[model samples]
Target: MTTDLVAAVDIGGTKVAGALVDGTGDLLHRVQGPTRARESAENVLRAVTDVVTQLTEHELWHRVVAVGIGSAGPVDARNGTVSPVNIPAWREFPLVEGVRKTTGALPINLVGDGAAIAAGEHWTGAARGRSNALCMVVSTGVGGGLIVDGRLRPGPTGNAGHIGHISVDFNGDLCPCGGRGCVERIASGTNIARYALAAGWRPAEPDGDVTAAGVAAAAAAGDPIALAAYDRSARALAAGIAATATLVEIETVVVGGGVSQAGEVLFGPLRRALGEFATLPFVRNLEVAPAQLGTDAGLVGAAAACWSDPDTFLIRGEAGN
Candidate 1:
């Protein structure tokens, strides 16, 4: 059987990862380079170029027909530009142009990282078989994507489901994004640890790191402050999830990322809080499931973007089937 392949690129603050992926979602060859996000824009672009260069040298490179990119957004998919927040060097960077220049005239598909997660989930992860769903990543930050009526809805700019910046607490703390009490302000791992610390929680041993994972450990050990922090974060997440569901009526919410590794520590409270906020009859049956794709969602989804079938076209911003 002849194998068709696509070049997949996942670009973020920390790294630019690339792969040659077959139609079945298998990564035939992979390469990566540090993003060096604070450096000059040219330096960061060089890193991405390095990853692509390596992929082009792979034995399977000749079989690749198209290219797909899942990037940390504020992406202008309509114009093939990007302005990722964490990567300060890039502002309206011609990412598609850069990739095209390096890899030739192959069709290039670009989408925000959150939308890629949604695409991956809808294709093969926890959101599989769901007609409508939300896929979220709650780690250093909270990012999300929407699946509406069995299709991914990446708005014109490719950032339709940016649930992180949505205000959940009007009178609460100001977020770095200049929003008041955004969901990311409370539910992100950074804030989870910050909340615990502000509430007088401290590591038992000297010189111990203070992090959300540490807080989860303390919460598991019955620390009141730590448990309270998780509860607060969960409540904020529930509010955001409920709001999204009420607006679009998603059937399930698939969550991934580092903070979600807390397992029941986060989900137990999140489930309880969701029950309180998602009170509408239509959203009462929303299911919250752990994502199964782990760290590979971006890569798999990038490859998935190359296909223009009726189901996948939704993610590529074509009219729904």
Candidate 2:
């Protein structure tokens, strides 16, 4: 007897990744290709097709039951379209229809990359076993997804728990999303590095590295400017997480992405800031932890979405069964 599997695709500005995932959340086969983000829309679709075609060549492809996609937002899962900010060439691209032509009649499901991370974490990572949680990616830009009542909530357009764009500072910096004081503007890895540089912080080794990882090293080494940068980022993130918890009532917040790898440098200040902002009785005890799935979260989460209610699947261009 063949084991059931899901063909999972993770589409991002940098790469298009595809994998065959089993019911137990294990990756059986995988393939990846660079995303020609600056090229034409057809080129991007070709990248996705190439990944899917590689998956189809796997011997276990016969057991694949469905295809699930986790693409960078802003995505309209209801309409099977995607408009990732980093992929400027794909404005309102019909990703579902494009991928469907490669997969034949297999059912397809779509969700924001942030939501897919949440689904992956809730299924087997840090948010696992939690009935309610918020999962975030704090990389070049901040993004998030919600898990309410033990189920992944991608919302109507698959962008529900986008905590990054929420205004945490009413009069703060302007965000690319056209919102002032958005969490992404203040707390993303890029912003953290920018803050450090603007504050006169220089790298210890003169490697000319001004990324968040460099800031983390400086913070760990007791550089005041670097420490202040991380502190500000942490505070912004805390405010966003607190607001989400207060409104929706979550038990935990699982953080992923490059900046989250800072370990104590980020989490220490984050917990302190959360204590200051989340003073409410109900939200005071919210737990925050690092994600365990690492880079596989997107692929695993896409498969997890397929294993969910078939009624929630996005078949062809229509939502639900």
Q: Which stretches of candidate 1 lie over 4 Å from their true place?
A: 308-321
TM-score between model 1 and native: 0.92
lDDT of each: 0.85, 0.89
Could you say which candidate leads in TM-score?
A: 2
Model 1 Cα lDDT, one tens digit per residue, 286-310: 8999999888888877776556333
Q: For residues 1-321, what per-residue lDDT tens digits would candidate 2 score against the true structure?
A: 025788999987788999999888999998999999989999999999999999998899987878989998889988999988778888889999999998988888899899999999988899999999999999887888999999999998889898889999899888877789999999989899999999899997777679999999989989999999999999999999999999999989999999999999999999999999999999999899999999889998988876774553334226223
lDDT of predicted model 1? 0.85
Which pairs of residues collide in model 2? none
> Candidate 2 — worst ten consecutive residues by lDDT sum?
312-321
Give the winner by lDDT: 2
Error of 1 at 168 (Å): 0.6
